[model samples]
Each structure stands twice: as structure tokens, then as C-alpha cells.
Target: MPDVLSTWIAQLAAQLGVDPTHVDRTLLLDVARDAAHGVARPAAPLTTFLVGYAAGLRGGGVDAVSSAAAVAQRLAAEQPPKTDDGPSAG
Candidate 1:
């Protein structure tokens, strides 16, 4: 992981009063990748942020994370494939 990302995660974990070991980095990254590929590149971070928010609202825990990730994965799977046609020049 990049130094910046590691630092951010550490800071976020500290602010949330949770152990950094509790954060499932792989699962979160997988969700981000799926969201970006299935939806749009810009959707990755936004989707992950929303998922984390949802998890927090439900009471932060492994279950909350799993539930949020599942929802995100489902939404990504349901997104329509991108098309080759570019936006109108106008």
C-alpha cells in the first residue's frame, strides 16, 4: 500500500476508535474495483464511502461491513455495460 493510503487508514482507524487490524483492506479494495469496473471509474471511491457510511449507521462491526459490501457488489453487478459511443460534441 502507498504510504499516504496507509497513513490515512491509520488516522481514520484512530478517529473511529477502532483497531487498524479490524479494517478489511482486501474486501474494501475488491468492492472499489468492482464498483469502478461495473459502474464507472469515478464511482469507486464514492461507492466505498457510502458503504462505510452505511456500515457506521448500522453500528460498526464485521457484520455491518459485510452487509454494506454485499449491497455494493449487487449494485455493481446490476449496472449496465458501458457503450463505445462518446458523448455528443455539442
Candidate 2:
């Protein structure tokens, strides 16, 4: 099973049209903020995911998942590289 963070990263990557492996800690936190404000709670992305998950379970729709994933992806893709001349740290 995919870990929650990994899963969220993957989902976010897909949404943002970016690579999952390229998403770093800073970008993750930024996206989490978006989820916090855009979803329900302002602290936990998982809480938002749970809300989405529950809605999906009830309606048999995956829109919420896709939306969350997309948000993650967008956040990752839009991030500026840490260094102007090279890639970021691992």
C-alpha cells in the first residue's frame, strides 16, 4: 500500500503536471497549505483527503481524489528551484 505522504505526493504530481520524485519538502508544505485552505481544515492535508475520501466512498466518484492530486502536482510544478543554477537537495 502507498504511504499517505507518498500517495499524496503522487496525487499532487499528477495534478500539477510534474514529477513525483522532484517534489521536495518545501513544495510539499506549500501544497499542504493550499489543501488546508482550499479543503476544510487549515492544518492537515490528510484531513482534507479524508473528507474527500468519504465523499467519494458515498458517491462512487473519484473527483475529489483527482482534485487533491492535481493540487499537489500543481504545487510541485510551480515551485522555484532552490538554487538558481542547479537542482535541489534530496
Candidate 3:
């Protein structure tokens, strides 16, 4: 799975004209996992996208990516778990 994931990331990066070295797959995966488990399953992809966007805005690179992902992971970890009951009307 690691080999396949690495290859896929490389191929996708190449196709997208991005540097494969800029992608820290494990870090990104961890961030996604944290977001999914901490917040909600649907938030995983969106969180990653926002992380990348934030990183890009701050001079994109490994450091930027790491910083953004770290912030996202922290926020995800701090989120309160959702309850099954709907919110009460005001």
C-alpha cells in the first residue's frame, strides 16, 4: 500500500506539475485521519484542501504544508464530538 500510494502521489504530482517532494504523504494522511475521526468523516477531504490552500497562500513548500497541517490537526483534535440529537429551537 505504501508503494502504491507513493507511486500514485508521484504520478499525480507530475500530472499536476507539482513537485512530488513537496508532498509529505504521511503527514497529510495523518491530518486527514485526525480530521475525519476528530470532526467528521466528510471533513477529511475538505480539511486537506483548506490546509493546502493555506499553505499555498503562505509561500508553499514543505514547511508551509507542515505548518498548516499541524494547525489543522490541532484544531481537529480540539473539536467537540457531535451528539445524535438535533439542536433545540430557540
Residue 38, candidate 1: Cα error in Å is 0.5
lDDT (Cα, tens digit) per residue for candidate 2, span 5-77 = 7898899869967556544445446556655544334434674455445545655234544555555656545
Worst lDDT 10-window in candidate 3: 81-90
Specify the highest-TM-score model's number: 3
Give the whole-model CA lDDT for all candidates, comma-separated. Answer: 0.86, 0.55, 0.88
For all predicted structures, in order, the TM-scores are: 0.80, 0.28, 0.85
Q: What digit string (tens of lDDT, one per residue) describes model 1 on residues 19-73?
A: 8877888899999999988887888999999988999999988889989999999
Q: Cα lDDT for residue 25, model 3?
A: 85
Native-to-model Cα distance after best TM-score fit, residue 10 in candidate 3, in Å = 0.7
List of clashing residue pairs for candidate 1: none
**Number of clashing pairs per prediction, in order:** 0, 6, 0
lDDT of 3 by residue, 1-90 (tens): 568888999899999889998798889999999988888788899999999999999999999999999999999888876555422233
